[model samples]
Every structure is written in C-alpha cells, then in structure tokens.
Target: MSNNVPTGAEFKEQLRAGAPKMGLFLNSHSPTVAEQLAHSGYDWLLVDTQHGPMDHEKLSNMLCAIASGGAKSMVRVAGYHDRGGIQQALDLGADGVLVPYINTAEEARQAVSCTRYPTAGTRSVYFPQRSMNKAGLLGYAGNANKNVIVALQVETAACIENMAEIAAVPGVDMLFLGQNDLCMSMGLYEKYEFPHMYTSPELQAATETLISEARKNNVILGLFLFGTTRVAEFLAKGFSFISVGNDLHHVLTQSAAYVQDLEKIAATEGKLWTRRPTALF
Candidate 1:
C-alpha cells in the first residue's frame, strides 16, 4: 500500500449525485483559451485529441490551465490508438476519457479496461503519473475506479446495433453520440438540422431505440453538439450529458459575428467596413 496525497476528481461525484452537467470542447493549441473556458464556469472541458491538432504536449499544458479554472477535464481520444494513449491520458490527471469509434460491446469493454488497475482491467500499474499530488500516489489505485468516468461512443450503425450490450458493460458510465459522424455514416451528414432527419421513420425509430437501451441499462446518455442550436432538442430527447462547440468553433463564430457587427456600424456611420468573408457563420 502506498501512502501519499490523493487526486481529487469532482466530475464523477457530480455524475453519481444525479446532476446533469454541460461543458465545451477545448481544441485550441493556446492553453489560455482552456483556462478561460474553465473560469467561465463550465462544468467540464473536453481536450479534443481525436480529430483535432491538439497533441499530448499541448494537452498537458491545457490540463494545467484547466486546473486553475476549477473545471474537470476529459480527453476524447482517437479510436485507432490503444492502451498507451489511454494510460497517458489518465496519467495527465484528466478526470475521465471519451473514446471514439466504439462499434461493439467488446470495444466498449476494451475502453473500460484501460481506465482501471489490474483485476478490474489491464492498465499498467504506475504510481508516478501526474495524477498524484505532491505528496504521492496516496491511494490512487483504490480511488480510481470510482473517480474516473469511462464513456464510450455509440455513433455508427453497428454501435447502435449493439447498443444494448454496450450499455450493459459493467463499468461503462456513459454513452455519447458522435452526432456528425453518425449522420455521415447514415448518408445524412448535414441533414441533422432538417425536418427530413426526423421525418424519416427509420431514423426516428433508431434514435428512440438508442435512448431506450441506454435508460434500460442505467447508463447516462450524452451528446456532443456542434453549437447551442440543437441543445434544447437533444435535452428534450433525453440527453443528460451535454456539450456544445469546440474552442475553434467558438472563435470562428464570435469572430464572424464581430465582423458583421462592425460592418453594420460602418454602414450606419456612412463609412465602408467591407471585409466580410463570403462564408462567415
């Protein structure tokens, strides 16, 4: 048994206490953006490492930035990577992890395995990861199981096909949808905001099925949204864990708005502020 200071992870406790939480994605290379979002009172932050340019080195600094903001951190890791990445993410003091491209229950099991110590999973035992406070390991192993949130993605036809079993995985805490990816897989890529998406009887049935399966198995249903546009719709559909917009998206959105506002002001004052992008939005 090791005696040292323990890491305090707050997200899992909020989850267990039946609180619904919201957060934003952090993909900017700038650590200050992460710190700013953290201080914005977001319940959590996802350091996106899957499809974005943010790497481990940058993520490390972002995690440190997040610490000061007092928000929990999660890493959305690429599915192609394996245990090594998962271990590294945990060691970096992330409160949890969300793995992408989970297409089966076995895949869900694999994701959960990497989050725990031996007997519970195959994650290598090492007390020296940054998760420990200055004091040391301090019962990290003993508390990890309860503190970490192991969430798996269910965003493909096959995953939805096996949603029931995946939801039943013993240690799985949440199932999130890669909404954009899932839409693409169904050949409905940009139709998410259109009426056809819901009018299609087949798609509607599948969504209802997924929600039923998650609730039946006692797992939280999560959705990563592109913006606040559909947050209300998703919540009405029963999403307990919600997130909207990445750092980059937020910047692009606000910057475009600022330019538009400036242009309008120039028009009112009879000066030309004509630098609007053709595709701003």
Candidate 2:
C-alpha cells in the first residue's frame, strides 16, 4: 500500500522564502535515469513530456521512480490546453505541473482548473491510482488543488504583455521563462554565454517585467540556467526557481569537456595516456 502523493509544501516554502530551488529536466524518459537523479540532491525534477518522448505510461513510471528521490516531480504536459495530460499527471502524483505557452489569464485559469476536481476545476476523478496510496483518495482531493504547484511559462510576447494578468491568476504558483525560446522570440538568435545571455536588453527587459509583476502579486519567478555560474545573479534579482540542465545534457557536457581536455594534454605530451586522467565527474 505504498502511495505516492505530491505535497507542494516545499515548493511553496521556497517560493515564499525567496530561496532558490534548482530543478532538473528529466528528458531521458528512462526510469533508471529518473531513479539516479532522485539521489542527485536536486530540489525538483521535471519530466519533459512536451518536447521529450514521455507518453502517459512512461511519465507515470517516471513519477514513481522520481518519488524516492529528494527532488519533487513535475510534468511539462504536451500542449498548453491539454486537460488529458494535466489530469493524468496529477492523478499519477506529480508535485506540480509546468504548462507551456501561457499567453493570457484565461489559459492560466484553465490550466489550474484542469488540476482540480468538479466544484473547483474540470479535473475528472478516476482515483485509486498510484497517487492515492489506495487509501488517501478522499483526503487527497481535499487539499490537492491548493497544494499542487502550477507553474506557467511566460514565453511569448503576448505572455509578457499580459504578465500582470497571468500573475493574478489564483492557482498559478510560479512563472518561468525558457531563455532560449524567449531569445528566439525577440529575434536575438546569437549564441551568448551562460549568465551573459540574460544580460541582453530584450532578456533583461523581460526579467524586469516579470520581477515587477511578481513583486506586485507575490508570485515566484523562474529562469532556465546552464549551471551554478549565474545563480547568485538571478537569485539577487528575486528568482526562486531554476532548472540546471537535463540529465543527458549534464552527462554529455561534462564527459565531452573531459575528453577534450585529455586530448589537449595528450597533444602537448605526445602521448595519449602519459598521465592519469582528471576526474571531472
């Protein structure tokens, strides 16, 4: 009778305290990878269903795998207006949900509604699933709507324009911007370095706008980060959440750099294994 439920208390605590929480996107869709990350000490893990290959079945497996980890489980459902995945994710025990392309207050409200049941929202109940522990279904319904975090992505110009309105949405817990897509929207297609990419006028303006709106509404602001390089900078500006990178990205980036460095040393010494390899991981 092991039941996995999403208690959004931690996310709420950090959001209110203004302390930063580093989340990672689980794009691998492998339960083993998800289990490995559970031990990595991340604050949260997002199963990227939007751009990744996690169907409902795999997403459910991931949610269960990540439950044992220290990080909270979140699902980035496929479409902005998808109640199917939203309801499915909530039912599968996601701590929160990240709805993409939230361009207006209405979409934000709908996203929140899908997470709730009849009287409060449009989420239908087919419980006794993994989230209920087969025991707490009645009690779970009582507090889920308020406890489950609902983070909306403000990625487009329309969303930025309606930032104030979106922030005012009752059930919307956090606001995030994927900087890469955001830059593409603003036509700033240059490959800027990490931390420095956020310094551009367009990105800076977007950050300022989110900051202002967040202050007025008491909402949390989020950004996508490559690593810990710019954490202090964004945290100083009142951001509470950041995704450090996906599982695949982390392993590949570190391993590739390690290999390249080894090649450099080998070239200088005229031997491939002249010395012991430095432990990068």
Candidate 3:
C-alpha cells in the first residue's frame, strides 16, 4: 500500500470527520481506465459490479489498478444478500463494499455480517486471500472488522420509512442514496420527467427524512450525483461521500461534444452531413 493511500479504517474516519470525499464510479471494467480515474484526484473509486460487467478476476485486477494510483477502492457488490460477492471483494483488497437495496435493519445487519469474520460476524476466512496477503494472516484477521467499510444503499420507500432503524445498525458506516431508484420507488419517475422527477416534492421529503435520520444516528451520508453539477449543492446539504459521475457517462458526453464541434467546423467550410442520434448509455 502507498503511504498516500489511506487504509479502509482511515477512509471511514475521514467520512465520519465530515470531509467531502469525492469519487467516481468505475463501470468500464477496464483496469487501465480505473487506474487513470484513480489518479485523477478523486478520494476514492467505486468498482460498480451491480450494473457493470465485471467478473471476480476482473474485479480483483481493477482493485489492484486503483490501488496502484494511491486511491482507496470500493466495490459495489451485485446484491445486498450476496455474502460471497462481499467476501470476494474484501478478500481481493478492496477497501470497502457497497451493498445495495437494504430495506430493513435485519437486511442491514446481514450486509454488515458478511463483511466481518467469526465472532464479529459470519464472514468465512481464507488464509491465502489477497487481504491476508496484504496485511498478513494475523494482521488481516485482527483488523478486518474495523478496517472494512459497510455502506448500504437506501433507494426504496421501505428503506426511507425504516431509516431510523437502518441507520442505527451497529456496523453500518454509511447510507448511500441511489437517486434514480429512489425516484422510481417514490413514483416520481413515472409521474414526472427526467430532471423534473429529481426535484419532486415527494422525493425532496424523502431526502430530508434520510438526512435527518442519518444525522440523528451519527452515520455518514453518501450520494450518487449524475454529474459534477450538483456537487456543491449536495455537499452543502451534508453529503460527504459523493460520486460525481461514472466512466461511461464521461466518455459519451465528451465524445458527443467533440463530434458536435467537428460538425460546426464542417458547416462553416460549406460541408454538410446527416447527424446520427446520440445515445446516453
């Protein structure tokens, strides 16, 4: 580990201390891109496996690449109940795991349990794992519980209703708000359109509920912003852990800008061409 890179425990401490830690989502599955983004001054990088294509081998390699750039690595495992996925990410040297769709305290407990070993929780130990290799057998076993972060996604109406209990879960370090899913759950997505859905009165109330409960429980609050546009706004609202955007989004947006610029230049030169529709994937 690089001296500049904070350990998982340190990263958690930073968040708890109210530092605005910014990060980007790695959906590209390419370690090269992951490493580049890690070096781009973000405090951390999340390897998104829930919607991104990444197998165990690819995940491990991406984690290694992110580490090489001296930034903390977090893996968003495929599901909240995926004990194996959680363990695999931690064992492969990821600083933390983001478990999605945790709707209740019991589910939150289960997610935390998967991150711990033995008496603390139910995580199975493997001596030859990357975690053990990095920290040594005894060192890894002794500190894994404290060093690993357990972040749960709060994206459903049920989770909002049970926010108090979910935030009070012993080992739950952070509650990450998945805005798109939350909007869908609140029926704002179907009722309204694109940006308007995000600003609905119902969604705003739910967000306030989340903030209040998180502050009341002394847990860190995280959010996934669509882009860098609303970063300052969310940070002002006490969201410290924020992912500005993802790799693919940046690629598409930048590529579209370049193409548009070329079209403008061609038009000035008396050249005309049909424009294809842009896909925002």
Q: Which runs in model 2 stand beyond 4 Å of their true positions?
A: 1-6, 190-197, 272-281
For candidate 3, give the lDDT of residue 196.
Answer: 99
**For every model in order, what is the number of clashing pairs?**
1, 0, 0
Estimate the TM-score of every prediction. 0.89, 0.89, 0.95
Residue ranges of candidate 3 with Cα displaced over 4 Å: none
Q: 2 or 3, which is superior by lDDT?
A: 3
Worst 10 residues of 2 by lDDT: 1-10
- The C-alpha lDDT values of all candidates are 0.77, 0.81, 0.89
Q: Residue pairs in steric clash, candidate 1?
A: 4-138
Q: Name the candidate that leads on lDDT.
A: 3
For residues 5-63, could you state the per-residue lDDT of candidate 3 as single tens digits?
Answer: 77778888888888989888989889999988888889899999998999999999999
Clashes of 2: 0
Q: Which lDDT tens digits does candidate 1 get at residues 1-281?
A: 12221233455444534566789987767798899998897878888888668778888888889877777788888872478778888888887899989888888888898997878987787767788763367566677887788888867878878888888988888888766667667767464566466346656666787889877876777888777887778777777688887888888888888888999999999999777456646
In terms of lDDT, the poorest run of 10 residues in model 1 is 1-10
Q: After superposition, how far is residue 99 of candidate 1 from its true place, in Å?
A: 0.5
Candidate 2 local lDDT, 1-281, one digit each (tens): 12332357655866768877788998887999998898888878999999898789888889988987756888998656898899889889888889998888998898888887778888887758777773488877877777788889878877888898999988778888787777767666665655465678878898789889978888888877777787888889988888888888898788777877887888898886533454644
